[model samples]
Target chain A: MVKEKEHEQDAEAGSYPTGQKPKYGPFDIRRYSPTQESKEKRKSNVLFFVALFAIIMLAVYGWYWYNTPGGERQVVQLKNALAPYNPATWYMGKLSQAQDIGNVWSAGGGNETLKGVLFDSFKVAGSEEIPQGSPVVFAYGLKLANAVVSKLPLTLSCNIKDKDIAGDIIPSNPLIISGKRITQNARCRFNSEITKELSGTVEVEGGVIFPFSTTDAKLKVYFTSEEMEQSLLSADEGDFFSYLGIDEQLPLRTAYNGEPIELGIGVSTENEQPVVLREGYNPLIGITLNNRWDGKMLNLTEFRLIIPKELSINQEISQNPNGLCPFTLARQGKTTNEYRASEELIEQVSLEKGRLRSFECWLDVAPELLGSAQYTVKEYEAEADYVYQLPSRTATITVKGVAGKETGIGEDLLSPLV
Target chain B: MGIKPIAIACICLVSLFFISGCDMLPNSIPGFGGNDESSVGGVLSASIFAPSNNGKVLSDYPFKPIVKIKNAGQFEAEGQTCITGLDKDVFSVFTGCECKSFKFEKEGATSEFEPISLEFGSYTVKPQEGDANQQFSAITRYEYVTDVTADLCISNDIYEDCGADPDAGGAIDAKISRVSGGPISIEGVQETVSYTGGSDTVTLIFTINARKSATGRLIPESDLNAQCTPVSADETPKVQAAVREFPITTPIRCRDAEVSADSTATIICEAKDISLINAKGQAVFEKGYTVPITFSLRYFFETVASSKFVVS
Candidate 1:
């Protein structure tokens, strides 16, 4: 009993029993009342951990902010603000804008001014100075503009003032403009045969007003009798002249300003320049009137032709039932005789705008007048009158010399020619 | 040493809280959240993406026509598509329906998806002796609505800074807003204001023009399924226009709402006896009130695309 009481007293006094030892070391006890070094170490660890945590939090917040929509928008704004300072970006932006505008225009979405029929370009595809008896090519282009839509067909017509030169237009008859096509090109070839040097203009007229009317549409050309046969044989054969080295000479010409109405007279004989009068040969005289006005058509009221007294109208040749000029002749004076056009002829023939109307008559020389001479020369006058009260225009004709006898003229003169 | 594990655990808990907090903020905000009703701006664009121009197809063989329709605008469109300009004798459609129906969801919305492709039924080329080329047009007809918002200055004084001049009368800028992208657009706006003894009247004119490229005809909105057929040249298309919102007590009236042959239309709206007073019966003279005027135009629009191909 005394020993048990002593053990209890020892345990109460915090002493281990007999040979038992404490499970902890001296350092464990020191942890309860830490020394300055240990406390300082603990404080330093806490400080390091706090700093680490702060850095990690900062990184996380930064990543979150950068990925946000508002943050991305801010960055985009900064980049845009700096874009103008960079010349390359500025130029690229301008180039893209210009390309967009060009694309819009190509799609026919812009430019209100280009909304009607437009006269695009006019060019003479051949030489400006053409050789006589050679073909001359005139090429012109017309645009229906960008947005002009037409359900009905629009017609285009062109006329050259000189009647002696004639050929087929590429798109003959009515030049119809239809469908969604915006452009049309036309070619006019004139095979000109001339007795003398000539300079004339070809008038083009579109039946519309404004753009078509405002265009000059006249092409002036010169013809020379030199090297006629050689040039005609060597003329370029195609729908259009070759554009190889000739591009430099094909620049568009300036606009023309002149009268819209013109008149020309041509005389053809069986023989060459110096004519020969025989039993069966007669001269054909043609008078051409051109109405270059594009606005409306003009009516014919009267037409009269006067010939030299040495020659008279061939009744069989000039008075054909289906002829263009059927006339009644009256002796005016000793020098000439006047022939008046019939009422049916005046009423049936009306000159259309931008077109030509021709009045032809045949003249026969009296065999008695050509007596005893190698040849004889004569001069005469021709005049015309219109119903629209246009001023009367006149032309002079000079027939060089006519051989008197059939034997005096060559075999070429005996054949029919024009 | 014993405190190290607790410190690491606390740090991990704090990091997790921050990462999770960011995702939760967007859901809590009212207007910032994305919804199915949100809209950007634009209209449906259609293009024939298959069978390239001048492509050759074998005679007596079946071929399919594919159209790409994209809903790039704000409105959900449901329309019918038809193929025209094809010779009935040369080509035969094997499908049961002449015109097929298509539906597309609006863009910039939560339910938006990629552009939907529409495929017409198989077409067989009829046998012919010689190869020939023919032009065919693809037409899409849909009922569409265009909305326009404009702000006009309502002032009792003519010399106010509402872009008005006393010597030249009261003519102000309409301050028209940008129209939503579509086949039709408002070209110009003109406004005129005249003052009476105690009130003022304003006149507004709107000029609208249709896109020239790939745009066909426009008709009235009533019975669109019945009127979406081919239109004659002499028949003029009509649009139903309404003044949805105006600040004045008097109702606004519009006139001359017909599309002309040039693909342009003019609508003139007038408001009579407009008093420049607030709800409290106070005059707004020194500072003019900017009244927002809204217009809604409903019409059925048709667009056509054409291509030429040879059938050998």
Candidate 2:
């Protein structure tokens, strides 16, 4: 009766009845239930873990944002700090006063001839070698296009800083005649003459060599550009003297030994040509200042271009057999190295007897129009005492080589090696 | 046992400190003024009596030496008149020509120039940090750039050569024989012509650098305390002036130079090359005159300052 009573009590407590397997399962699948305190404790434990994870994640991301390395953007790469980007100014050089040189006039359709001046012809900066049969040209004031000739007897010359490289300065009895076509008249649209002119072709047949660059390297290096263009639409030396404020058509004047009276920027119709400050006299362009590195633009701080009177090509003509000795030059556009000329003009120019000289060239003529105005040219004389001043230039590159045994702190610097 | 809760408590404490300590905004340093930039260690000043690039500072190494030209009379300003000596076009001004004439009125509005650009530079002093009373700060130096340029134009005015500082250029013309008796002179009326008596503008640049000071070093410009000395903080540089004739004997004509034809027929005017230093303290001008132009009446000349030079 006790066993029966105990069994009945267990069954009433909701457990599977000890002898009730005949109809259903003997045990309940559900596990034991927790007390109220235990349930609350479990909830708190889960909350603590979530909070801890969030704190750690925030720290890691914050650290990465401040200390991560990349380009200039990241904190570790922010070495070029922005203390203050206050840029100061620098004084480059000063300019001289402006002087009136000459004027320009709209001439006619006949071939044109420029006869102003070849103030000075100087070779500045490092020089290069002209190989045998190689096309060569000299760029000088006013007639820079005609300055360099081809098909000439080759002459060897070299240039370097302070005479490191030397070549024959000028060979005795040396004359080179490269058969470059010579034509006149084809000035710009405003200065063109009415007719085409002819330039005869010949070879001066002598060897003259310019062995060195400017003798005095201290001859203030002007910011000059010999960076020639494969594209040559205009033969304006003004591009070379871009550092100089003078333009291609701007007249050059003289300051030293110039007519006592200094002329200014003016023009007049004296010889049918509208000239800048023309007064029946040879005008000059003088350097207005001496000191360089002033804080002004287009500063003539270092040098100036002075036109020479003796070098005037437009002098009165006296009829002669060698009318315009370099006939190619008289016929304006007839003489051009722009295109590969006829083989006669583009003939091979090679060195002989260890010197390159004499070559063939064309001299243009204006027989049809300038019969009465036929002119003769004086001997081609370069200014013996003149020297050209090129502008100074520099390029800074961060050189990186082997640091060797003496590695220093700077990116490209190194300490003394043992 | 208490690791999680302890971590949470630590995080809360850290957040409170961060929120309370950081400002994340602009803050001014104590007792500093005029573009003062402060760090945890020191401060940098932008306008600490900024000196000009010209060598016009009163001393070689001024402690906050800044030059300010005030109350200068306005003169006639012509674009072409500024670089007339090169005789070349405005394009010739920069190409490789030297300074013909460099003058600027050091007083008032005439002295002000266009804002120039600055290039990269650096300044430093040995042991830059120290006490003001015990150790004086070492010399500070700055190497900044003041290079600027503008396009030059050709002045085609017919009257450009007639007593005209047209783009600072002139053509040789017949000289003025005599001064017309008038009530005006061309010096101030046409172009301020003052000849420097055997004077040449020799450029001398002075650069002073004020490194990041450890202690707040009192700048002479703004510091006027009991400890301040009688010396002015804004010391004036030694500006030299003189008169002389230029070699440019270009013939110039003064046709109708006088503004009024009826004022004074016997005006006594002297043709001189007036010159002064620009704010940068470089001799800017040395004007040459053909002859003095007399006017029947007084006419003020406008000063030309913006002479665009050709950049080579």
Candidate 3:
């Protein structure tokens, strides 16, 4: 009755109230519909079209509303005004604080990425200086503690914090060298290990080297530097043009290790430094001690000294008064001892302790004979390569015995030329 | 006149107007509530005529795209080992470099990942020839990609007590990083724009021939433990998605898309038997429409359609 009324009213008024009418006013709705009613109705088609059309229009208007960077930018800024400031750029802001010395490092990159560098090349560009002391060394060594041996000053500084290293240790802390004196003082401690054995000739310095105890420690030493290299480099081993590395010369890193040791520009000393060469019995010419046993309790019988050829003294200048200087090599222990070679131009060559090897004696000439024989060539322990192509020049080296056995001229002790 | 005739005339006129005026007009749609001045070639963008394309296309309720610039530059190590200058191989690596951005645009704009070829030019460098110290390669290849990026700075130069101690009492000596270069500034875009009805896939690539140069210590000393390793060029590449609704698909046509001022549309879009393949390129999403994830949509229109709205 409601539908009939709706229809009758719809026919007259051209509209229908919500009713059970299948279709009305030329409308037909049915096609792939999701309902059995719509499939069967075959009406309300115009209803579907109208609904779809309305939906599309709503979409069109939405497109014109939001979604543009310009609008977004302003909106984002306004949002930020109400939010907290973000802290992300702080890290990138801290890269300019290097030690910035005029040290603008300059180098070219290679394909492999590692390049050769010269960090301290400019320090000693033009100067030179040598040390002081007797150059020949046959019996003993010097024992100076904590000393600086550098040509240029070095500084260290760090920021290494405790958190930097893995364990709680700080790593940023830099070690800064405040001044030259300070730098030297910090670097005086030298630590190295070297051992040698000598047999041919033995001479021991007395009283000076460790209270002349036979069982006391034997300390060895040496001084080296680029300056030393320049003086003691084998004159025949290199050419002027090839000094830095050619046929005979090796790389600078290699040359540094092989250079000989030297000392003596000239320094005044009345008591003399405690670095004696040899003083007791001329242990070189095969001597036998009878009174007391000495030397590290290990008995000093079968020994061998292996010095490189470059360290041997040549006979060419052995005759010159510039030969070598007077230094003692002794071994004073708890009893009487054996004798080597010494000087009355000086004192007795005491041997109350241990023994030394390959001894040589020299003297200071008069100012008148300065050019002829007034030099002191250091005598080092003789090695197999120390043979003078010429012959052993003669010199009068004195010696003192216990029994008062009258010594021969220069033969047994200073053995002058034949 | 009869009252029924009078009522019928009013209803017919209203329905007719509603049907005629609710058509999409991508090119001439006026602004809605927001201040969007976007247009393409002086033409207003098409309005979204279909109810299906309303909210965010991204699955996430809130979507964010992260961007980052990594290893901004580097110094190659081929030529530095000798007395003579660097070798040519070092320059080659820098010359034939690949600068890429991995991003995915709106699906119909872009979806799924694929390879993009790019060719950039080479560079030649000399010792102290220019303030630049090294020559950079020219971009020869370009590819657009999408990925999520993280903003974490792992500093390599900080020393515990020696480097920069923000919480320290003494002077802080540190090496900080400076973001000298990266993406350029973009002027805000203001032109009518429209994207097609659904998400689209897009892929654009181009080459940038930028040279990277840096100098400092690298291979650590022999006495020092654990040397620094070379940064890999191929590890952990970035992937991101970009979105752009081109005005082409969303045309500027002559359609009146004004929804009835009083009525809102309820749109329901289903998978409708999707024919898409998974990343493995296998057919997927073909099952029947899943229910109750009932994504409810609500929208309003401004027009006299079906007597739902009155004429102004």
Candidate 4:
């Protein structure tokens, strides 16, 4: 009983293992501390919020890019790639804002025509500074986009705008639409593959060209079937509408693709001053070679000068040249002469960028017997045939209001070089 | 940045570059044939009609036939002139005096004219034997001039731009837009003007040759005659001589007419005159006196036609 009493006293005095304090490492003590736990929880919350914000931002950006005008275009491209022949997927990426359009036609076959003609784009390819009337040729191109179609006829007729059909083809009168005359240059094919290709991947091309006039103009094209061609040839406007099985402007329209095509046209002259080649006078035709084209290097082939009969370039103008080209002088009429530049001489004239070439020639002018009422200014067209850096082309320069005399270059003088 | 993030950034930059570059591509894929920008030349198709060709005229002396001009091609006719000259002097008045100019608003349109009738003096008609009909063929000439402007694509590069490809070809430029020339050919005048006279009258048949000279193509007949046919009173009837030198200083004048091309036309001219009784009442001379008279012609003509084309 004395021994038991002593043990209890020892336990009470904290000498036993149960009453002793435990040894603690840095991790164990801090893990249990309220302050350290709170700090760790706060760090975890910050990381989660950052990740969520990043995900939301990415998603929002994706949605925006897919909806905007530019973004929509990308979507169309992707859709077209997936299902090329699907009519619903027909979307020309970019389009033109044109006020005037000629002979609008749809791609669909038969009377149920589609809306608008699809244009890939229109661009100016090149330009030349002519003498007078400041005549400039605007090199342009038109790409007819794909048309949607189901199985229809094997034959398709595509007509380029403003092309006059040879009178020999069909004895038909022109169809006047919107105060403009529409002529047909029909491209008819008798194959189903053509229709498929046209709607699928192929696009029709029209190098629609015109002189730079003061006013902006619209050009047109016509797409029709063999039956439609007959109607166009035989029917008037009312008759045509009746034949087409509809009235009013059909829903047929046109659309374009891609950026506004840039026409690489430029005037090479140092100054904008216009030059007029006068009649009955010898003048130097100076042309500066400026790289104003999308293409490089102009490989000249021929230079032709169409002069009024009133004016004569060296009767031996052909002989007067360096004899570099095989020149020909032909009478366009009793009142005009066609002077053709030699191919050899033209080949020699490599009009490189920053180069200046002068055509030294003599012009003989004769006065009309009855005399012109006034100093009439006529436009003379000078055309040069050349190869652009990539290929060949022709540039025309016009000299305006040139007067000359009939001093006498006649049929006797027209004997081409034997 | 981490490797993955850096890689993503690089990809985004590359994509932007491609998007910009793609815009430069030709509107068309290279393999597809190029556009059909071909232009057809304007053709002038003209047809002529005369009084005899349309219908029979009752008895109207010196009736000029109606002249009609048509624009049969797919182009507009502008500043077009139709000049008609009588080969015979039987008509007191002429058709298409000093030329007539007009315009055709559209293709396949037409213009018509009815010439006036002018005849001098009186004539007697002798009925021909059965089945004999005298239809006089008069001399008519037509000349015209015009100008036209069209769009032409001039490219410094011929092979790639215009000449090489079939679709690249363009219309060759015509230096002289003037369309004045002798459209009349070997066919003599289609109609006739008749002046019948009595037995006392002298019917002078003048066969004038209407040769299309190059000079005539460039100059008007009136101008040529004005320069060549000098006016003179020297040939007027001499009060003493029975027959004075021909009324005009020059009895026959070619009037500056020279043929540049090898071509000729036969023009028939007829004139009737009553017997000339001197102070003494008597016939001037024996009947059937046929004197030859010749007058050459060089016509002046000018006209214009226009066509429009769009090229890209």
Error of 4 at A256 (Å): 22
Quote the lDDT for B224 in model 2. Answer: 21
Per-model DockQ against the true two-chain complex: 0.00, 0.00, 0.00, 0.01
Q: lDDT-based ranking, best first?
A: 1, 4, 2, 3
Model 1 chain A worst lDDT run, 10 consecutive residues: A101-110
Candidate 1 lDDT over A251-359, as tens digits, reads 2121222223334444542212223344466766555554444333245545566665656777788774234556668556554577767767665655444455666
TM-score of chain A, model number 2: 0.18
Candidate 4 chain A, which ten residues in sequence have the lowest lDDT sum? Answer: A210-219
lDDT of 3 by residue, B24-88 (tens): 54322321112122222211111111111111111111211111111121111011100001112
Model 4 residue-pair collision total: 65
- List, residue by residue over A154-217, the lDDT tens digit for candidate 4: 1112221233311111111221111121223322221332221111111112222111101010
lDDT of 2 by residue, B202-263 (tens): 11111111121121111222212211011132431111111122232322222222112122
Can you give the lDDT of residue B289 in candidate 1?
64
Residues A1-418, candidate 2, lDDT per residue (tens digit)? 6656655666677565455521222233332346689999999999999999998998887766543222112331132223123232111111112221223221112223321112123322222221112222222211222233453232323332232322233331122333342222111110011111101110111112221111111111111111111111122212322311222233322121111111121112232111212124332111111111111111111111122122222223312112111111222222111111122321232211111111112222222211111011111111111112222111111111223422112313323311
TM-score for each prediction? Answer: 0.35, 0.16, 0.12, 0.21
Using TM-score as the yardstick, the better of models 3 and 4 is 4
Candidate closest to the true structure, highest TM-score: 1
Question: Residue B244, candidate 1: how far off, in angstroms?
Answer: 3.4
